[model samples]
Target: MPDNSSYLVVPSSVLWLLGFAVVSISILIIATMVLRARRLRSGMHAAGATEPTGSLLPEFEKNGQSAAASLVQWSPETLRHILAKELPDAQVIVVSNREPYIHNRKGDDIQLVVPASGLVSALEPITRACAGTWIAYGGGSADRLVVDENDRVEVPPDSPSYTLRRVWLSEEEQQGYYLGFANEGLWPLCHIAFTRPIFRASDWESYEAVNRKFADTVVAEARNERPIVLVQDYHFALLPRMIRERLPEAIIITFWHIPWPNSEVFSICPWREKILEGLLGSSIVGFHTQFHCNNFIDSVDRFLESRIEREDSAISYGGQISLVHAYPISIEWPPAHLGKLPDVAQCRRRIREKFGLAEDVKLCVGVERLDYTKGILDRFDALDELLKLHPEWIGKVALLQIAAPSRGTLPAYQQLYEECLHRADDINQRYGREGYTPVLMVTEHYSQVQVYEIYRAADVCMVTSLHDGMNLVAKEFVAARDDEQGVLLLSMFAGASKELLEALIVNPYDAATMGDALLQALTMSQEEQRQRMQRMREIVRDNNVYRWAGSMLLDAARLRKRVAVDRAVGAAPAAPGNVISLLDRKRVAAL
Candidate 1:
């Protein structure tokens, strides 16, 4: 009121200042976003530099509206070329529960650590075959990623891998997702042992959220017209459908790393139909064994009650959707060359010293993750019973039990660990004479080299999974033992049992059976062990991991037949100077 003219001037100046502040704030925010985007782009670019990209996919519509069978018979190379074309800018995104490469981010730099997955050995060839990108979620907060000496992010060709973002679960979320959903529910349910599965809505909700995050990542990474996405295992079961909805044109492939139970067992899942539909959304679904594939097909038909036409290698449902057939897994045998290394000999000696073993004790080794499903308790009980029944041979033979720690956070796993420890202690207490503990039980995990050495030195290799998708360990042990000397005591329940029938089979659930099998194996003539090992090795060597991968792709290609056709159309009108005919065909070629 005292100075009207001066007040008006002050108000105008204040307005201008406010406007400037708002503009500055907006600029800063935009700058931050730009920097973040650049960082993400740069990371992807580095990973993709070595990959192949282009529109190599066949225009299926242009391929004469052929049926699924006709499509499979197409030349493998041609089909891959077509697929490569479709994914012209194919950024191979490999999404899994575990990170493909563990990045140790320290300030402005990053260090990558790769895990020792047997799957890697089988898929590495395909990864190396194609140019692609890779993404993955790494080990949980505590366990550091296990890196190999190679210092390379090992992956297949025609694939780019990257990790999906997981909201580093709080302690509560972890319990619900890992403990409640994965272990308590899916773990037991999938194994057809439903007594332990406890249904929880909240835990399942968390699992859904986690899988959605993975879907979001795939949607964000995939290009509009040319994206082929591959999802691994059960952790992200709903991801295929989620991504399918967003990227309708993209080709999705889902591979189940675990066994899919039959109708009777699968019915227990509260969301069984949802899982089946989620998988069905993919253009292709792959399983480790034919039985698993058949089980999945049965689930879809029984639950969905959908009309399915089963062909030789594939199943066509409702004509529009085709569920392709064939097995898609193999073991990475650490080649014969590995045996020649000086370090190999050294590792064997180290294994002997670490366990304090004498040269004469016939070492029978069982190396497995310390999980309840591994039948570790049964193994211990069997060993105990064996020693009790046959006291004379106690010191003559040692069961080298290497129980590698896995999923220790879960209560069930922890209980298993405690039980294992107690069993080991009891055996040592009962059997100890002067120094040697009959059961050389190792709770800690050894390096891959050490494991290889253990496999080489053992007179017998044991695979005793209660319910396994495919115990590649059985195959791996056989591959490593080129001498074909070790007798393999395989569990009848394991998927590997279907493939490895020559080995000594035992019902892991029955301690008596296991003990008997063990005794038979121990006393088994050296010649018989060699013969069985030889036959198993031949099968593993001949089929090989490389052949397994190639077979899948080949089967996919073989879905349809390829007929020689001209680049230009015959009956249809040609554009201006470009006239062509189907009659002007070249000789058909094999892929």
Candidate 2:
């Protein structure tokens, strides 16, 4: 008892020193923890671990350099390597309505024709880089000629790289699915360009059937492993849910390659809720702009009972969270052989001769599919107004409107084509001279080389879309202008208008304003044209198609990783019950 009391009763100075040392040590430990925690959070945020507050645009950094900033120097090999790093054991599969290469019957010989598609140009490199499968509709006459027994062929015949899996649909299926539901219903529904959307029960049934068929093919191709499936456009809006039902673990990404109207506008569809549910099945849904992304999220919030994460731009439904992001698509930059001024000049000469135009005449070129959305009629009206306003340049300026025929079977498209012809005729009749036509309408397909030549030769390139998601024609024109000599008369409605601010943007709906823009483009100084084209070329060259695909892929991978982490932490509950409630409580407590 005496020894214990002596041990307990220490010296006052010694006790004070011990107390000071303990307090100092505790403070040091706490300070170290605070600093370490800050560093950890900063590192996680840099690595895209923390959810973004607004506009969840992917910021990819490599070698301490922004990937997007360095995209101009990156080759397809670099993009492929990045994909391999991001998805180690996963195979990439692309699903779209249009095939990159079409083996069509040209006379007796079957030839491969790469259709004029921005989607093809953008995603083809990704497929080639990953050596993946691109599943598309086999609409070409000789599409079956090139495919192996598995209905798969290595595309871009001369430079075979990736597998092209063609999905053949019956005539009725194509009619109902593509022409009926997709073009008539979803196309008009999405684009708020004053076109009425037509929805029919038969078309809906056909659309569902085609979606199921595609999903089956995708699943069969996926087989044992869960592959990353990238569904393209509105044609397969229902495919995501179908694929999700079959393979819940698969990483599905759907990119809507058009504008998304507001929720009120979108609610006009009879099966809007079903469409929303189907879209939410994806791990991620992408749009071309932030406005479109917001529209999609708002539409989902309005139509479905889902937890909308406004900060992250994600929707949590049925125990899963799907990210919604904007990935503005673009064209391949610095088009091959664009710098061959001698060749371009020769092609221009040939084009002028074929079209019966003088070499000195200022050529305004507009290239687009013959669709109402392209504002072809509006372009003609502008041309008519251009001639009327600028009487001096009646015979000096001509617009070479090369409209590739599209969906000719549809009445709307047919009427559009007819109206364009009538307008062109009226303009030519009113303003044409012996050697010059105000508008030269070429209703036929042109090869890529020819289109590039047109782009290089033109004094002005016009993209007058009523509404579009990244109209690549503008970018293509920009890429082809190696000399930086052409003016871009772009419509304010196009997605490209946001990036190509140097272009003389006009409202296509206003004919008089568009006429003035055309005149301004025609009368622009050579130096001004060069400056504008240079800036636009830089923009296109920097934000090329490769960067677009890479950004989407990186974001999709991050979303999948986040979902996996949530599942591991039991934050993603399968059913709405006590488990979810407990997880929510834990999350709130942790926060």
Candidate 3:
């Protein structure tokens, strides 16, 4: 008791020193945090992650005019104001599932890294060159930014002209909708694997809920002006209807990247009607080929009992009031047209040497992503049949199948990979010399240059997809063949096959047809191969990806102009102006 007070009370000099030390530590921490924040902002700026603000459009003046008034009632003035500022002039937002870059951890922080793939080439410059807005979710490597529930990764000001937004999905929402329903249920079914489709009531509900959430996100993000919303693929089919309901004036354009099966096959799915109605909500629907467009129209007609207004260039749903057209999406070939480098020749030589082929041996190549619909097994069977039917060509020629690894997460894909391995082994064992394996199969993806090498060296290019939207690989192969000594034996079922009639078309399921076609292609004269390949190059070169994108945008813009004119003339009474005409929030909420 006597010494307690003295012990508790420190000397004034000691107390002062302790206080100074604490303040110095506090200052250092604050300084370090400030420096860290500045670095983060710089990083975000470099990665093109800044939020878009103010008028995004320069051509249109901000004088309280609405861009979408002709299409729909511009009720919300804020949406109109934002659209006047954000569209057609500022950076155009190209929304996708994944962000452009991947992020890595650095001692409680994260760093962004770009993916080395064809996607990078496809998206990077397209996004960077645009002076419009880009609204995309933080996918892949960019997911690291949302490490904390409360913390938000700031988008820096000096970032690229693109405005990338986040549609961060909760864990439950992702598992139930994305993994469970979208992948397991719709993905397999859409690809025409009816037996494999895993349907669940709960999954359907989750998917609907997620669709509603996505609609909410788009409605919240989109301006009320004429925002050209180019929605991509089947994953967001429901989004079109949602967007149409919310932002009816927005010019919504959708492109289906996958194959559209005929009503006979497409009708197998329980969600067929829902999918069709969802797609019809868009102003324009694009398909890779005429057959796919026809299939879509046929499906809508049969399933929904809907009338179709068929025109020479386009087809319109009678009741839905949406247009469907074939765009035949393609790759950019002008870069390749610039001139071949010396490395291309060297690359071809290197690929031939690496594959351990005799200088005179003919190479028949088929490159594809390792998916069930790609007909990997059937192609192998056809190859086996060819080798068995004609023993003379076994050692003389080889089948080089480049099955690129994709969707390995799916059990069906894993099983297909295993089947491929087994078949490759069986073929080699059945028809192999002391040092020569008859079938030269590789189960890995090649670099773009490597792919170019295969295309150049290949005597015959084979695209045997059971179902494919538009096999760009077929076009790529044709484009790279500067020598024009490549015979393309393509599948009739593929959407590209209709466009590439010059190629020797065969049914993938019909073994006799495929075998006969492959053998004929192998024996075809160099002149014939060159002639066929030249025609294909002409078709692809004329209808490149640039043309595809430009055509869609121009078409939609033109349609919007007509609608605008009609609105001005009072011919379009559907879209009445004034917010008061719109159903109140409470009434809308009830619906």
Candidate 4:
């Protein structure tokens, strides 16, 4: 009676409906959590099973006969055996921008230097095992001196196992194709690290021309009709399509070794359609994670009118279905560098002596190229905060930053190099005493042995990337610490975080939290370090680079067989002179 309309009383039926909806939502969330828990439990239980199960190559039936499912103890030897068995007639061809080994002029002699690249580290071992041909741009100073008349040279000067085909690029081509488009445009676009991507028509043109150049080289290098081509990284996105167009029967597997942005983010790129279409030309498109694969699929949905079969993770376009999958890249187990490094005690003592630091002082290592996306500034800022917050650690804990010079010609990278030096200098000025520098910044390129020595020496290894495909440094750290003593502070943004579960995952954006993580790593007990490191080691060991390569190769083999059957049954037409990869070529030759 007293303004009942203003009181806004709900009806009993409506109230019941609202309550029921709320209950249903809550039940759904709880059920989801319960299911997730059950899955984790089941996985843990399955880990104890003695029966062999395929962890990478899934059980697939062909022509009503199922392939025997067996878990591979993935090693270099095992990988070779599998490669030989999977595609006996095909060649293994690895194509990338950076050569595995660089020939630099060292005074009067040519020095065979291995570039500090995660790509090289991962693929070199596989090539060695398979005796594959690695085709890359010849950017090194003395690259032309060692190559034969055919622009090819056998690598591993100590023990030649594979061919290194060098593709010469002019100064303009290097500037526009590599530093301009690849790094400035695509790299920053893919990784939203606050830097605006610089896209130019000239850079795009050069990129296309370079891709064409590489494609011609690839076609010329193909000894077999259908080579198993592994087109590596962003630099070769267009190369896949170029090769596919020419050699329709060639099985091209393109592995994007970087993070793929969401549709909205990728929409900013003007050539997004071309890049997407180029990538789709592969028989398989691989990313470091499923999240990236999803982002790529979403981008393709927005930009291209391709048929995306969500169930199979395959994209159909131009009468071809490209299988998109996650192949988490990893470092080699018992790293090649490991055999060259000294014992932990010796490493610690020698590094401290070299740096003129006391033995008791803690050494924290952060290794990266002088690139903004690596969050080197954030790492320095976090260390600065840690020192400021904890005065007791002022002279006790030191950060040894190992920054390798990369793309110095780029304005952004040059600025980063300067800023990092200034920042390190400021911190040192504020906190340093004679023989007690809080921050030791080394910018010179270090060999694998020296890097591994530092890894073994440091009590903590920090990889704080703003965003990364998969920072192999994290895995490399775990591999180097076979003594199971070092702690790894990894960025949550890195793809490696998904695999290295035992690492101290921190957000690179949060300085305070990262500082705390550093403190935690510094103060962690030896036993705890051993436990965490042991877990990471097992993960790295089981899922090594050999396993990574094996997984891709296995999937490629399955697809090849499928295509062969299709052709045999006249379901698919055959192209003339088809078949093989850098691996397929060398491995077939090796066979």
- How high is the CA lDDT of each candidate model? 0.62, 0.80, 0.64, 0.84
lDDT of 1 by residue, 1-591 (tens): 476765535587899999999999999999999899755533322211100111111322343332232223222243346445533445555566665444566655554444446555444434444444344544443223333332124332124432233224456666776677877888877774324777799989877877777677677656563365657777777887788667754556677777788888889889898877777666567776666777888888788855454422233332224343435355654453355544434546676787788777778898887877778778878887788898877887788888888878777778888888888889888987775777777887565556677888887887888888777778878887766677899997776776677999888888887887888888999799888988887666545555444443432332221111221333332110001211111112112
Show the lowest summed lDDT stretch of 10 residues, model 1: 48-57
Q: What is the lDDT of residue 365 in candidate 1?
A: 90
Q: List, residue by residue over 238-330, the lDDT tens digit for candidate 3.
A: 878888877767777788878777788777677878878888778778776655677888888788755455432233342235667666666
Candidate 4's residue-wise lDDT over 306-419, tens digit each?
777653466767767777777778888778777777788999899888888888899999887888999999999899889999989988999999999999989999899899
Q: Which residue pairs show collisions in model 2? A: none
The ten-residue window of minimal lDDT in model 4 covers 48-57
What CA RMSD would you report for each candidate? Answer: 25.5, 10.1, 29.2, 8.5
Off by over 4 Å in 2: 1-72, 337-343, 563-590
- Please give the lDDT score at residue 126 for candidate 1: 45
N/CA/C clash count, model 2: 0
Q: What is the TM-score (0 to 1) of candidate 1?
A: 0.73
Task: Please report how far candidate 3 places residue 152 from its true position, in Å.
Answer: 12
TM-score to true structure, per model = 0.73, 0.86, 0.73, 0.88
Best by TM-score: 4
Q: Please estimate how well model 4 matches the true structure, expressed as its whole-model Cα lDDT.
A: 0.84
| Top lDDT hit | 4
Candidate 3: which stretches are off by over 4 Å? 1-92, 98-137, 142-166, 170-175, 192-195, 220-224, 303-307, 312-320, 335-344, 573-591
